[model samples]
Target chain A: MSHASGPPPEDRIREDHRRAVEGAPDGGRDTTPAVGRRGGPALWRRAVEGSPVALARQAFKDARWSYLYKDDTSYRVRNGADANERIQAAARRMRGSTEIPEGVDANGPFINAPVWTWEVPAYFFLGGVATGSSFVALAADLAGDERSAAIARKVTIAAIGPGAPLLVLDLGRPARFLNMMRIFKPRSAMNAGAWCLMAFSTAGGAAVAADVLGRRRVAKVLGAQTALLGTYLGSYTGVLLASTAVPIWARSRLFLPPIFVCTAVATGAATNRLVLAATGMPSGHPTRDALGTIETVAMGAELALSSFNEKRLGQLADVLEHGRAGRLFEFARWAVRAGLMLRFTRGRFAWEHHVASGLYLAGGLAFRFAWIEAGKASAGDDEAVARMARGKATVKDRLRDGRTTARVRTSARHPGRDARAARVYADAVRRLSLAIEGVLRRG
Target chain B: MTEIAIDRPESRRMGFFTDTTVCIGCKACEVACKQWNDLPADGAVFRKTSSYDHTGSLSASTWRHVRFVEQTEPVPLPDLPAYGGGNGGHGEVDLVAAAEAHGVPQMDRWLFMSDVCKHCTNAGCLDACPTGALIRTEFETVIVQPDVCNGCGYCVPSCPFGVINRDPYDGRAAKCTLCYDRLEDGLEPACAKSCPTDSILFGPYDELVETAKGRVLALHERGVTDAYLYGAGDEPGEQLAGELGAFFLLTAPPERFGLPAQAESPAQENGPVATAAGLAAAALGLAAAVGAFARAHRR
Candidate 1:
């Protein structure tokens, strides 16, 4: 094994490498022996080998023994044995239908799914719609579109009417709702969300209450304030999801909130359109046309943003694209697309508009519910989480090892660096440390 | 208002650096935790699971958990020393014949890990708590003030590791306190104290990191190249050592232990979302302003 290797010759070095090449014009000769030559990226590449994902994937492929049937574990099996054999064997040994099989444990550990159940998602949906509607109400009121304003305000009030109760219900007790107000930590998304929810409901309810009382000026003032609170209300739920360790949520932290905010606007506009159609608002009316346009554009923005976010999320994107989340996500996407297509085909007066508006409303709620489902799936899949942390595979590694972690630093053996230079560097470091200590003492 | 300072402490952070390689799958730490904390029973029945573990996970009731992860891979032909061996310790086993005779196609690599709250520097529970309930103690450990918790369940989904949980009966969020009370008495946490194999080591957070790294290096020298320390480096988002008060020297990927791959605490989410909301609100406000301007000029 001839180990004589040193820095590359001048001819072998590219312009970038030329600067570091010992014999190049810009560099000095190291004169190190061949065995101790410091060289290129091969050393660095070897250092970064075997990331957790690659290790796990290797183990998975190497698995030759799998239980005969579907369960969480791999059992030793002959080449052609049925995969469910383990489950079958366990079942046979069990007493009856009432007895559960030990092989059921093969599905692996019971990942504690997100404890936030139906009430939480329902609250997210209601709050998003309410926030969306508040903006519509404020804009319409400001533009002096009294008819549209009145309808929008009614939708906002109606959505929020049950929102407070849903939030309390999700907390399990009435006291928990009050506990949310015990402290204000502005930096905390949860704290900010709670405060914003409270403000939005109070201001939105007040605006509608003023409208009911025939106080137009007071209603308009409170409506604007409600929109102000709605800004955070519409977007914070997405932030809440993104803040967790959930792979799907954490992977696209920057864009999830934007996607949520845009969707909120779409849902709000759709709610107004539905309310207007129910109240007999004319399709030819400019206010109705404007709301449809807003809904279409907002849905478009939401779609574009989330697609980009998903792409950036890499492996974690599967969290949103698989299982129950996948079905719901597909339906929501189709609903948004259909809703937009309906606007181009017909005016708001057409029956298609009413259906499309309902689709838009349903799509928004579906998206929230789907997002939570996706989070649960991501939590369950250990491999997906590992891949996400290691990041998307590069072209070369993706096919092979898939184990390239961030740093690949390798210790290059430098031949006896004329001892004088090393001695000087060591002396300097020692002196520097002592100097810093003296400075600290003097201060 | 609950005060939330998301910064890591300047003082020495006391923590546990669990070396999973040395673990012997003992439940002593779990028992010690329950005894010291006076926690209610999570039951001793053999729950059907993918592995030998009966305690499924960390919860409000059960603070310490041991995971039994079984990988379906053949061991190397020339077996190296098992973890925590190699020093006058011989653990060589010729299982090739045993594996094939059993009708098993390949070898089995069963790994066990003792799981606990990471006591993350950017803890989601501490950041999300609205009632001043979850707070970082002076030791840089996170502890939930049970009496202060209102059980809003915000802290439940907020935790990246799902370590903090709300009990159904108690209706309050709770989790491992890292034995803050014991630490105050100059005693190590119960779990670490009871760990027979020294798998779980408690010390200054930085010191434990060095020790863990050295152990991983030693394992590598013995030809166990797969041995690695998780949560010890600057792997961002919910990682230990780099961002957690409690880190681990894991023999496998963290997710295999049910830990999140990318964990961003609640506090980390605020900046980006707030920016998006700000920009969106500004745009909407501008649109509303233009509409108001148009209405005023229409006359």
Candidate 2:
């Protein structure tokens, strides 16, 4: 009713701002004594009011004052009202303007959150590379690329140097590392990871021993076994993480194994490139080019799969995309891109190969390190965990009519059906995730 | 892995159903747990800050902890008119008159809940333990074989609840054994035995669950709408740590009592790991085949 002949919306906003500024000195000051500030207008005006706009801005900063203003102004703005009253009236027009009460995370919820440190991620990274190196060695040996095979074998065996100590170091005692294989239970991923690492290391060690002893048949046989164990070693760590209740790790359960395996191959091939390049394997050689191409594809797949999982994770993506872990994840992406560019450049410098492989290795390590840290961040946040838990629907369910229950409990009585449902639940989630990712990419 | 930690057919399952509503917050259970377990006093560092909490959390030393959470709201309990029984005429009359004159405003409510090890059904720490240091007892409770533990700290992160901690002096993972020694002798845990108000009740698992359900129903009838059982079926507790040996009757959100509202047990929680492994293998195989094809084409 008051705005019957007022200016346009934009101009009205401007006029309101001007009026607010003009009324600030006296109108805001005069109302202050009623609110209980000492020595009233003089002190408060000196501290708060240069203009009504300044006072309003200060009030916005103060949650309590904003609440009072919002509470007072929310209905009708009087055209000739006092500036403070007009400001309140203007604020009343805004939607969802609720006061934020003062509170605390009194329980120190995030403290003692995640105990995983350098040793665990380092073990995962080195062990994965070793596993992939063994696979590369096996592939080379089968392809009759003896020169590539021999170097691959040496790299595979040698990669265990840091890997062995890392596992032992995390265990805190050498005997404890041995004690991990007290009994093998296929159901437990940690147990399986432990035993897989042990066996792979043992076979890798034996193959290296045979190389020195000139036992050709023995070395080949053991190398094949190690490569087989490498399959589990390279990817089981992801399964191990997925098997845990950790929010970040568990949410990415479907994609983690594939991502880890891809990373393992990329890192392993990068290490192989460094070894071959250092040993004077010329650029554009068939074996070298093949390994580099394979590494590139694997890494690209890893990035795609990681993005897919992150998309499905919804709000939980903050941990992997926001904090210190987020920075490391960002660094890995750049490193991957830079490394890929260097690998393709025709006239790349001899040192360019070294630098590229170095970046690839750094990227691999960063992925593992950031993943562990992100798991910590994910666990600390209550909201993210809840959101992820709520995302029980797989991509299939999202698209289809028969949506699986929010949580599917498997009964022991119907093992076969329950197992099938569990498998379907998992597959539906991953397939749907990939589908959603495809849509997002196209969109 | 063993389904429920306390489902052993040979021995009856035992647990504690702590009713936080009636907890006195005296820290007696904390003292009793340490005393009976022969634990060292690490909570004595009187940090003058923080809430009125000394034994802030359950740790290797403090097996039980009473958390005092002070909330600034009008007190839940109404002002009583019968205090001092109106015995002293001048003082009592003056106090009553003063009470009528000034209304109680912003009365602080301290939510005191004693916490102990949850002894989760699908124990992540036990599943994650590589050295077999952690084991599910025949009594359906989980315990750490301290002699066998090599302090790998694997169990530390595995636990959804921050219950287990390493003894800094001994360098081994230690936590509430549910008084395994006493349980074997048919005795309740010291914390339950010592609770003055019977807030901490120990008995057969099923019976304790029934008692908790009844108490929650009673509280609801009495208009305590927020009162719900933690670790009770149909709650988020059942979703993760189903039928927890040590559960609670909380008057507010689990977070208010420093508890995770939705606890997840890794073993019970399944995802697409197996399918992902298969996909990974298939992708690698395809990549390898493409690499071979490219080499042959170049030839």
* Top-scoring candidate (DockQ): 1
Candidate 1 stretches with Cα past 4 Å from truth are A1-112, A172-174, A212-214, A306-315, A347-350, A393-443, B1-12, B44-50, B71-109, B206-228, B233-241, B253-256, B259-266, B269-299
Model 2, which residues run further than 4 Å from truth?
A1-112, A172-175, A210-218, A321-323, A386-443, B3-10, B45-50, B75-106, B233-238, B271-298
In the range A306-407, model 2's lDDT, one tens digit per residue, is 888888766667888888899999999889888878867853477776677788889999999989889888777755443333333234222112112233
Q: How do the residues B1-299 of candidate 2 rate in per-residue lDDT, one tens digit apiece?
A: 35332334556677888888778789888878866776654525555655778666666566788887777666544232323223234366544346546764445678878888888776767766766667777667788865456566667656767778664444457888898766654567788778876788877787666666655554544456566666654422224355577888776555566565455555445323443564467456534834563564368
CAPRI class of candidate 1: incorrect
- The models' CA-based lDDT, in order, is 0.63, 0.63
Give per-residue lDDT, candidate 2, residue B262.
Answer: 50
Interface RMSD of each: 21.7, 22.1
All candidates' TM-scores? 0.68, 0.73
- The CA root-mean-square deviation of candidate 2, after full C-alpha superposition on the true structure, stands at 22.3
How do the residues B25-74 of candidate 1 rate in per-residue lDDT, one tens digit apiece? 88898989877776655455576545567777888768888887777666
